[model samples]
Target: MYTVSQDCTFTKLRSDSTLRVLFSGSLRLKCKNACCQRWYFTFNGAECTGPLPIESIIYLDQGSPELNSTINIHRTSSVEGLCEGVKSGLVDVAVWVGTCADYPRGDASTGWNSVSRIIIEELPK
Candidate 1:
């Protein structure tokens, strides 16, 4: 499963007999100016559920406004961990935080933005 937001793609990967899901994603933020900001984030199936979020790491890239960059958050959290967390029922929700610093260097009016409380269910192991 996947959803598109702000030019960001979030994909859920799974297999039979597995309760874990690998969330692979890429986000792009374009400003009216010539600069660009891109971000990549990933989550384990376990972290995609419940009322509280499972501890996860997010890697971001704010490169040239006109160019595309890739950030692989999965590399920091291996697929194995994702599976374990889901199997243990230790994941609940995922949260994303965005600040004006994430946008263009000079554009400060955007203020703070966030993508929080993303509800995700754990598959039956």
Candidate 2:
């Protein structure tokens, strides 16, 4: 189970623009559940239809519990075509965490934790 506590929306991005997705949060696992967790970003809205071309995998263990990561996406001519239908409207960008069986046992809710924040920012040319 995965919960998104915060989501950042963007509307002014152009086909020629490049952007970076910043994700920050923390994770804690009991015992020796240290493992690699994979996460990805998806776009859902009037124009965009599916997951972006970026993905990340982070390792979480008793030694390290904090997560701070970034994924950069460039809107090239080829990829820009995918967003042409978007026109001018807010697009919802989401971050999803991959499932892991080692998640704390108990209620499904206990198996997941909240993502502190997901931010989208345009990069300078």
Candidate 3:
């Protein structure tokens, strides 16, 4: 669990203030045919409904799709979205990621000679 904010208080956000989440990372996925990965930020343990989630669709090598290759490729992606209608006094912000694809025999790794980051900011509403 990643800590987005820690002001030593639960009420870090006010009703007049709005918060947004940003995720930046590189994903390494093995492409057999095609794969679509979904990523989203969770507000204090629940999925945020304020902004659209991130979607990454990767296809097999155009040159060869039936090759039984066991290699993974790296793709960098970033997503930033607002968290609307969130409950007040929430302190912890989390991130969620999952893979959905046919014949999902591949694995995803976020650590590949790169650092992942998550930033949360408060804005005046």
* lDDT values for all models: 0.31, 0.42, 0.57
Q: Which residue pairs collide in model 3, if any?
A: none
Q: Which candidate wins on lDDT?
A: 3
Candidate 2, residue 119: Cα displacement in angstroms equals 2.5
Residue lDDT tens for model 3, 1-125: 22222112234557666677676778665655554444556666666665544333344432244576555778676767777666667566665556454534345556467777777777777
Cα lDDT, model 2, residue 82: 22
lDDT of 1 by residue, 1-125 (tens): 12222122233344332333333333333334433322212344223343233332232344344565332222222111233233242333233323333444312111124332233444544
- Clash pairs (backbone) in predicted model 1: 35-65, 36-64, 36-65, 46-91, 49-92, 50-92
> For candidate 2, what is the lDDT?
0.42
- Judged by lDDT against the true structure, how good is candidate 3? 0.57
- Candidate 1, position 109, lDDT: 16
> How far off is residue 47 in model 3, in Å?
1.5
Error of 3 at 35 (Å): 2.2
Q: Clash number for model 1?
A: 6
* Total backbone clashes of candidate 3, pairs 3 or more residues apart or in separate chains: 0
Candidate 3 wrongly placed segments (more than 4 Å): 1-11, 51-66, 101-105
Candidate 2, residues 1-125, lDDT tens digits: the string is 55442346787456455555555554322223344444455556221333244454444443322444222211111012122233334667665555455543211111134335556665444
